[model samples]
Target: MKKLSYLFIALFSLSLMTTSCREQKSTGEKVEEAVEDTGDAIEDAADDVSDEVEDAVDDNK
Candidate 1:
């Protein structure tokens, strides 16, 4: 009975560890997606600024 109990405890601990690892991986993916979205936004803003500058220069000409 004691051996069975130890086995059960060990299995439960292993299950928890696996679940925690999966959660960490999910969190990492979310962070990577956020960074990609932020990078895209920055790129868009830069493009808009460049377009505005080009328009101003054309107006001066």
Candidate 2:
């Protein structure tokens, strides 16, 4: 009976560890996605500024 109880406890602990690892991986993916999105936004803003400058120069001509 004691051996059975120990086996149950070990299985439960292993399950919990697996779940924790999956959660950590999910969190890491979300952070990577956010960083990529931020980089895209910065690139778009730079393009807009470049276009405005070109337009102003053309107007002067």
For all candidates, what are the clash counts? Answer: 0, 0
Which residue pairs collide, candidate 2?
none
lDDT (10s digit) by residue, model 2, range 1-61? 9999999999999998887444345888999999999999999999999999999999999
Give the residue spans of candidate 2 off by over 4 A.
Answer: 1-25
TM-score for each of the candidates:
0.59, 0.58
* Highest-scoring model, TM-score: 1
Clashes by residue pair, model 1: none
What TM-score number comes out for model 2? 0.58
Residue lDDT tens for model 1, 1-57: 999999999999999888744334588889999999999999999999999999999
